[model samples]
Target chain A: MKTDEKTRAPVARIPDADVPGTVERMRKGERRAIASVITELERLSAAAPALLRSLQPHLGHALVVGFTGPPGAGKSTLVNAIIAQLRQQGRTVGVIAVDPSSPVSGGAILGDRIRMTAALDDDGVFVRSLASRGYLGGLSPAAVRIIDALDGAGYDVVLLETVGTGQNEIDVAEVADIRVVIAAPGLGDDIQAMKSGLLEIADVIVVNKADRPGAEQTLQQLVGALSIRATMSDKVPVLKTSAINGEGVPKLIETLDQLGGKVRAEDAVSRRRRRARYLIARAASDIVANRIKAGSKGGLDTLADSVLSGTMSPHAAATRLLED
Target chain B: MKTDEKTRAPVARIPDADVPGTVERMRKGERRAIASVITELERLSAAAPALLRSLQPHLGHALVVGFTGPPGAGKSTLVNAIIAQLRQQGRTVGVIAVDPSSPVSGGAILGDRIRMTAALDDDGVFVRSLASRGYLGGLSPAAVRIIDALDGAGYDVVLLETVGTGQNEIDVAEVADIRVVIAAPGLGDDIQAMKSGLLEIADVIVVNKADRPGAEQTLQQLVGALSIRATMSDKVPVLKTSAINGEGVPKLIETLDQLGGKVRAEDAVSRRRRRARYLIARAASDIVANRIKAGSKGGLDTLADSVLSGTMSPHAAATRLLED
Candidate 1:
């Protein structure tokens, strides 16, 4: 049961009995079994294959919304407000809060865990905190798989929280149905308008901490930026919310409702399919890379020497290794 | 020259010019075309494929070192110090600083560029700041390609300065021969030392800004943590340095020298191959996923409606989408 002892130890695979039956039952709408299996998977990469198999069915059903912004932008608070409102409408929610863990200790600071104190006790709400674990896009490949697992587990909504401000956090755009980019006042006007590659991915932008001094200014600045980029069809909606005082929480909920409909109805399914295929491509690349790396450990040094001596170029040498 | 302007633009293959006809000449032990082609590519990525192809005979040779840590951890300063030490010993160094651009602005803060001031004016020192655009790893997929470009260009030592701290940043361990994870004192001893996936990948641990009050204590804490996970082959060396004052820089450089050799001689080839393979897989996945998504825009909504209407289970829907 406790499989993670040594690095070289062969990782355990999900039992065949559990795997096939779980997949079948999950397809037939078994929730508790799927959720239990998913929890066990949190400890290790084991159970991932079975989980992935089970997740195959829910690929496009649940709406995935990603929330990201600078720290102290009231993201967690806003998420809580959104969760509460969604639950009121009888929606089952799956929440993943990605907290930064100790690089050396692997223990989570659990910042969001502590903050989402309200969601912990709600049975309708399943809040799981995942360590960023140095994942670039603020999430991991495994995280993408897990999102699928949650979607399969019958949750009506899945919310992914990412480390804010850092640029690598944009990987969220690849996986989510709706992206809520949060920002606050005093962060500069240049920060308001999202640009070509980064902020352009946001479906909805929320200026949190609306009670702050420059909230209106931030809002006005954002509107100005959007005017230049907003095509008649691609207009990004900006909303103001005080997650602390609960201002605009209802409006935020209403906005989410609209976005959800937009994503699932006209042209949204095609968009998500493209994202999913990309995820698959990314996974394939990771697998091949891991294999080639595992095979070439012995020859790297001599290659380096030959390279440093000007006897070979790094590109040529790299190509050789790939060929080998 | 400028590709991917339209979201659906085809992925263009780099011409053989990306790599100079270095392999052909290198087989004859000649250098005629290699230098000229690589020199042209130093200005940008468009010229990479041609240079890469031409240098195919000489790659997988350079000792690629990756430097990463939290912001303000003195990574740039340490990088400068490392380069100076290497150059004094007559090593030609190529430095790549991975700076994720503001998605909205398509621009980088260029902070790391300022720190490598010492190398800026040196012809032997090739310093580049890369935006972690599109790729999750701190370095771009194009980054490895660029490193190949540099390797063919004749730089002996390639150093990667990853500007990300999350999991995507952890992708550096896949590409570098030696990974130097830098940390500052007083951030949180347990937090820094306990990072789950990030700290485990370090070949060398650096505690920069060691002049602070708790610097010594921080070093002690780090050493203690490393001891628990330490292996006979991997006793990650921890160094204390003040990049600003240059104290302990020499020791750090010496450690890098020792470790770089170890990685290059024994495992260098496989490591680079693995990195290349991984990039290929990711690229492939990106292409596939993008196309699938473009084709399946409203599939999720239709599925969601089916599930909500009790026509199908969530699991069933997901499986169908993935399979399709």
Candidate 2:
């Protein structure tokens, strides 16, 4: 297990602002402090930049493993099983469960939390459920910051479970070091998996609920589909696991361990580079969105009026915005 | 039906570029000319801006209706029925079906095309299947341009059917004058629809495949959900349809026509303004993405290296890039 040297540092007291103290508490693995930072970042407050900057040196220690699939594909159950196995091995884990928050029924996140209560009592495990706030496709904008906070707090592994429904949820690919795509049998899950385009981004394919009928067929279908892309440099492994009974959980963990080490050794720099690029793009987009929302002079409303009145084409209007 | 007077004007022959000629041909309702323009726009060619500029005066005729739901919810079947109903009323229709492109399988789009073959032989109807090109949510960047072309060519209605799996697919809400969310029985589709947050954006809720076993229950569930949200100013209608046998499709079409007319009468300016804003935002994001990809001086790589090496924070790096 990789440990941060800063984990042993003493909690410091800071005057005027509680951010530094919070950072210190977070570095010492205080769950409350970590939760506070995540909430602040989600709110996108002015203090967030300072809090994140203070936590920077302590980041990049945790291995982020993303588990994604269709909603009913047993991803939470699989995640719960994996957490149990990781806890058994004496590894600290932080989980970020990204759930789609609906305007009507907003209780699905609560259901997810209830389903993953296996590790709630264990100090080595910390789980946080995040509502996507309708951002869609794996993680919310606040997810990157939350992951950084968890990583800085010295978790050996950070598990990100996202409900993959459409192609946009592939945002997990940018955040996770290892991407696992899960599927179940008899739900037309094989087709659903293909439609979501999760197969392309998966580093590991897991056929969960493997004890169910048609499990073998689904696994074979995935293997066949993946084989067509075998010309690619990396050959992603497809494994089967009955997460409910803990069957194949050990092997899954072993595979993850091996893949994790190999990735860190071979492509860590490129992975970090990719993540940095994603972060930069996201930040730039957020800035543009804010500018448009704030209705700065020559911003969206002005351009929109021009387009609406037929004074300018939308493409031309867009080009003007880009130039601005 | 709304018609642009600009469509009756003589074809202006420009000396340098034949784009005006193509636009002239498209405005005369030539299917080949429309297809060519759509292709050029999808390619994002140098001539696309000129082509779109020429078509602008002839635009804003078609009522763009967005139909979205989870995959296998029979969205295509519903769309086909809707198209047939529109054609029976002597209205020309254009359909854009957005399918998630899988790098491995790449067959979903083909399946969609096959499913909607009912209107393929009809000159009054045109259908195009667009690969999302991994661009999640809304229509592809090219889709906006295509819709404009179709509108300019004098299609009475342009139907956009998107597979809504995740929340981000709500991009359709921005583009469509009327947003219809479809759900089918016995797939936990009620829950799935709720999770995708489509209820918030929907102008019409469709329970497709209404002849299925649990159809009444699903319909009731949707009604219950919508009733809870009845406090909102816009009371979205929940309707049942068996698209397979054309049951209730006419009522759905009538509802769409009423809603479309109502929205256009009430908020047409704001709707166009919103679309312009979306176009501008998309254009700006594309520019930033291209800049990052091109590796401009002091761009992503330099900042990424700093972030990777722990010299700068991801948030700070992102902020710097935004300022640049």
* Standalone chain B TM-score for every prediction: 0.72, 0.77
lDDT of 1 at B68: 71
lDDT tens per residue, model 2, A1-324? 222244321222222288888888887877788777777665545455567678767766788998876655778788989988888899989988766644455646445464557355666878776766543333455677677778878889999876535433567766789988887787552244343456657788899999999999888877777677756325788899999899999999899998888777755456656776776665566566556645664467887765544345555776677676
CA shift of B26, model 2, Å: 7.2
Whole-model alpha-carbon lDDT for candidate 1: 0.60
lDDT of 1 by residue, B110-154 (tens): 543444363445666766655565223334555666677667566
RMSD of 2: 7.9
Tens digit of per-residue lDDT, candidate 2, span B1-324? 222244322232332278878878887877788888777666554455566677767767789998876555688778888888888899999988666544445656355565557355677877776766443433565677678777878899999876534323556666788888887886642245343455666788999999889888887877776676657425778889998899999999889888877776754445656676776676566566556656664567888766544345555776787676
- The models' CA-based lDDT, in order, is 0.60, 0.69
Lowest summed lDDT window (length 10), candidate 2 chain B = B7-16
